[model samples]
Target: MTPAPAGLTCRLCGRADLRSVLDLGAAPPCQRFMTADQLDEPEPGLPLHLRLCADCLLLQIPPLLSPADNFTDYAYYSSFSSSWVAHARRFVERAARELLPADAFVVEVAANDGYLLQHVAARGIRCLGIEPSENCSDAARRRGVPVHTAFLDKATAERVRAEHGPADLVIANNVWAHVPDVVGFTRALATLVAEHGRISIEVHHALSLVRDAQFDTIYHEHFQYWTVLAAERALAVAGLRLVDVELLPTHGGSIRLWAVPAASDVPVSGAVARVRQLERTAGLDTPAGYQGLAPAVGQIRDGLLRLLLDARAAGQRVVGYGAAGKGQTLLNYAGVRPDLLAWIADKNPYKHGRYAPGTRIPVVDVDRIEQERPDLILVLPWNLREEITGQLSGVGRWGGRLVFAQPRLTVIDPGAAAIEGAA
Candidate 1:
């Protein structure tokens, strides 16, 4: 792959001096994980630099890596995890009760494998999904969920409006923050949704990411880290206004925002006002918030690298758990290679036969842990550390320990399960 650019202008506000909060050194491009036969030649490493808009307090990395580079046929599948399936089902059920009626149309963006939209369809409501990943779109189609394999923008919005009329409910989860054109993307939603339509967007809360030190979520694909304040500004610029909001435990503390056209009757709830107040208290939407993250992020990097180096020096075999996107970000930023981690294990079959995004570490079955019997196991998807620790309970039969790096690096014996509020 070719390099994208030296840096990018702010997608939300078009400003530069995008202060660098943390720099994860170059590693193999994440999501370029290939088969053994394709491994003779390697892909190029893009700069994994994290920046903040001092003016907007938006956390983002330059699109040093473009959307097309990362979103190929085999991007991601949502049906693999039963836990996530339940999460989607609950979301649809709640949406049906609180937001949508039986006769209205509901559209989902990046509706991989129709995992969430299936619930909406089952409620006898009209539904459509716009997914860019061909593999995931095919899977969704197989499940009888109509999916369009195309990137959504203003033009597509007009086309959809001409064909199916404006949507009554638009649901985009975790997709809004990945686009470089925040204004245009939200404008598309504004165009595609009717005046009476309701739009709900879910994205990682940038404020929580900084306060909790979830630095791993910073990557090439995630274009912007959105806070309620930042999103409100972008949406308002696109002719929409936020009405209601909720903080979800999903994806390491995400914000679910309900919005409508600026002229609509959707009442702006206290939740929106409360979230703005929270942003002010956290110093978000300003340059000071961006400046404050630098020092704390440095400490996290130093701590994790020191632990890995010390374990290597002591002749301990180390392995990684979870081939998660966030894990890839942390590995590339820390400059960790296959030399430090023997291999990685994951439950997602889509990645089981592939290597990691940047490290080129092969992903094997969960038994690799028991077979290799590594002295130390680093859990990359530390958010799921509890579930993983529960499943891998036998790791301690040979005295193995599991370590997680998040707010800080902590090592827990398998017998210990997990620390409170981890991940």
Candidate 2:
């Protein structure tokens, strides 16, 4: 595949001293789930070079594909994971108590399946979802949430504001990193938000990515990674102020940042200062903090490959669970093919007969696992291991075990049932 124009400078800070941190080989668009007929066709793969900006402490990958190529007909649905949906429900409740006003207008960018906006609408408040994926947006509209099927940028933000007025609360959860133009994305949110409005951003913390060795989360879809410091810098550059920040445990480790127009009189919350201080103490302010990640990531990849190869050597059938973006990255980077992993099982019908993007492994329904009773089930999305393990606990009856390949390759013994938080 041809390489797209790379961003020579950092997305947050216009610096050219971006240091190479990790190279996980070539990867395709993680969300590009292929159909059964397309499996034999050639797939595109772009260089995966994760770079770190010393100037702003931001971890970013250069732009490789246009947003339309990645998001227009996306296959990812946030409501698939019960835990994630529960997390969104809890977030909506908390926002109602803390940030959201009684009769406020709420807008969520990159809202998939109206997971969070459904809660806002249920509370009798005015809400809208700005999602680029037509399939996801259609699902949201069916759930009674008004949605705009357009990518959020400066122009789209202006049009949204003119049509529906400034939003009292604007949310861009998990989309900030997906945006190619980081500066323009921030400025667009600023345009949609009112002067007194709160702009909430949930991003996977770069510090956590290094600290926890979350290399699987690094894919072509996520263009940038942010620490509190880097995020604050980007927001400030777009005429926004970082008012508050909360470190959440979701998505390995994420930071929910609260911002407002720079000219607002809102006093910055103590949480912001505390998180900044915590990040600084964790060595996020220097280049040494970013060191050692490449090695740890390499170790995990090698370990996972070893387990799969050993299982195949022993004549054990190994099937995978969860056709997630992180799973695609991990499988592709580890050079796992259909022979080693067989097929992956997912509950989403849209992906049931489809093939994985880069690996081209067939995605079958979850019942197929019970039908085949593979000896070892590799749980690809390790973040939802507990939920998935519990759902497939019956596999243990047939002497089937579960495996995970994050931090390290762990094999859960057969008949070992998991509680909600066990994993």
Q: At residue 243, what lDDT does model 1 achieve?
A: 91
Worst 10 residues of 1 by lDDT: 1-10
Q: Candidate 2 has which clashing residue pairs, if any?
A: none
State the TM-score for model 2: 0.95
Model 1: per-residue Cα lDDT over 231-346, one tens digit each? 88898999899998898877778899999999998678988888888888987767566555657777777787888888899999999987878888888777788888878988
Give candidate 1's error at residue 287 in angstroms: 0.9
Q: In model 2, what lDDT does residue 53 have?
A: 79
Q: What RMSD does model 1 have?
A: 3.5
> Candidate 1: where are CA atoms >4 Å away?
1-8, 416-423
Judging by TM-score against the true structure, name the best candidate: 2
TM per prediction = 0.91, 0.95
